[model samples]
Target: MARNPAPFAPFEWMIAWRYLRARRAEGGVSVMTWISLIGITLAVFALIATLSVRSGFRSEFVSTILGANAHVTVYDVGRVGQQGQLDRAIADYEGWAQRVAEVPGVTRVAPLIKGQVLISLRDSSSGAEVYGIARDDLKSLPGIAQSDQAAGDLTRLDEGIAIGSGIARAIGAGVGDTVKLTSPNGVKTAFGTSPRVNAYEVVYVFSAGRYDIDRTRVYMPFAEAQAFFNREGVADELEVMVEEPEAVNALTIDILRAAGDRAQVWTWRDSAGGFLRALEVEDNVMFIILSILVLIAAMNIVSGLIMLVKNKGRDIGILRTIGLSEGSIMRVFFICGAFTGLIGTAMGVVLGCLFAIYIDPLFSFVNYVMGGGVWDPSIRGIYRLPAELNLSDVLSAVGLSLGLSFFVTLFPARRAARMNPVEALRYE
Candidate 1:
């Protein structure tokens, strides 16, 4: 009696499934299969996790930097020198600020006096950037609205000043304490030029979520800042915030036209371009390096499938003799390799997403065990490790892995399909 031909199923699929599940003793599967699967899983995990962290870091950096600074700044073309220039500039500043505020997309316009001053509390002294801004403008500043992190009321800033957490710590000054500020631009005296010195009461302490700002920024009332710097009624620059900071470039012409020829415009991107560009370059390089890792893993699939074909020579011969076509034979091995890759890719995607989501806690746990700052945020200029899982990145990684797996299987699958049944059986 004639037995069922290849179990009465699509011989290609049936053979592929059987080969995948075959025991070591039956010569169906080998250690190489598991190695390839594990390799693919690891490669996918690393790629996804790294890319997510990179994206997170970029977002955190941008937000933190912009939180402390305006999206755009308008500066006077000439320096504010004597009383005449200072008075005229101050008179024109209000009009300029009002006109700029009326421009489309302009959310807020703040006239500010910024200058470097030496801050001293007893023996300890540190150089700090002093910003004189209106109390109302504080409400519009990003990261300044977090009342939990601010020690005192910004509205109460009159003769008092607010210092950053870093500045407070550096000079051992805090709320209710007094610190001295010395300006380099001093007044001329009969005895010669004397540096302008003044004492300020620290009434508030703010954490701007940025290392540089938190470490070196001090804020005072606009009028007080102008008076302290000996440039009463004059502002050095006008800081402008927009509805959408990323689109500020599009609004440059409108802003410039509003400010007229006396003021020069500087966008946030222009100020931080070098740093942002470096980060983008680094992200691209990392992707390329991680992709190479996946390629290496894919090469393992090639070797494993080749060995699978060699070890199953007798089985291939029997299937050929039983009327399985060369096309079916090739598909059997192709499915075998593709199936392994697909399973690995699925597992990797799941694992990578989970890893990215819990990366912060995982690092904390590791740091506890290791007794060190393994993932210190201060080292990277942010407050924590951020991870933002991107779907496109995940899909790209998966597609690359599977594509490499499929491509490598072609040569080995064709070799298995083209084997002479007589020769394969005679050898077996």
Candidate 2:
């Protein structure tokens, strides 16, 4: 009786494994196999790493925008006229805010006054966008109350102002310094137009970690702004926060209904829609382009296996003579190709994840060596090149690579399987 085959040994797999390990002198196509393996590895690495970094950038940008602004804003449409109408509309803001806060998904509401002004220090002056927020409501804004870089308490702002780091640097102002604010909306006197000018001590300097915000925004107490702008009883708009920012569109309708026809609502997406849409389009294009790269790498598996089949022709004839079924022969080459793909894909996953995890430090090291601020926070509103390794992305990449590897194997494997023993040996 024939000895029992080892518990798990299958003839096809055994032969495939032996062939894969065979040296060049022993009929193994080592060079082509390695070339195929490396190609797949590099392709997968590029795919995962590029996507991860792009994901990181989108996440960081969205958070930065939300930090500096509310998810939804309600504008007083009725207040867009002469002083009497404006005063009447503003007098009803509290009731409108209360009604909006009752709307489903509405989380927080804060009234704000916004206008253009010129900020001046002893040495410098620049045009700025000034925001007047209630001191109690200041904490509702993402980066307002928690900036470690701020020199004073944002919550305690009274007659004082909190300016961005960029503004501070541009105007040469610091904590305890005084800056003059001149509103563009001025009053007309007998002589001419008089711009409303006032001085406020700089109690806090905040870095929102965003270039545009840090460069141009100034925050002061709401009541102070009302007085300074000569709109004593009114705010320009209401900043609304929702439970989920992505659901702002649906909730915007609710807010509008609750606030009445005199109010108009806009979501953060509305404010930054163009920029966000461009990012989404770019991400999709990148995926399509990188998938082509992966497909090209898969083609290498086809060439390598085709070469392998030609080199192993004599062995194929011998194995066929020994009663190896055609299906078994096909499976042998299929397994060989698949094994190469699996190894390369596994390696690529490891390499990609490691690269993403250490991306920040790697960039820092390169920047230090190059003696340049290649990843400028001031330019992108981010301190580093962010990377987020999504598990689905990794899994999708693996599935795609393996599917391509398995698919490319079919033709060469079928050719090897259909070899007539006589014809195969005739050449040998």
- In order, what is each prediction's RMSD in angstroms? 3.4, 2.8
What local distance difference test score does each model get? 0.85, 0.85
- Model 1: CA > 4 A from native: 1-11, 79-91, 375-379
1-428, model 2: which lDDT tens digit per residue? 65534422488788888888889998788888898899999989999999899988988888878777889988866633554544323556788899999998988888888889999999699889999898878877777677667777765588599999999999999998999999866776898768999999998888776888889999989888887777678778889988898768888778999988788888999988998899999989998898899889888888888888998999899999987778778889998899988898898889989989999888889998999778777767776688999998899888888888889888899999998989889967
Candidate 2 lowest-lDDT run of ten: 80-89
User: After best superposition, candidate 1 residue 35: deviation in angstroms?
Assistant: 0.5
lDDT at 278, model 1: 99
lDDT of 1 by residue, 1-428 (tens): 85434522476677798888888898856588888899989999888988888888888888876787889999877755666464224447898999999999998999998889999999999999999999889767867656357787776788588888888888898888989999987777798778899998998898888767888888888888887777676788899999999888999999989998887799999988999999989999999998899889878878888888989999889989987878788888998888888888888999999988898888788888999767654567777788889988898889888988888888889999999999889956
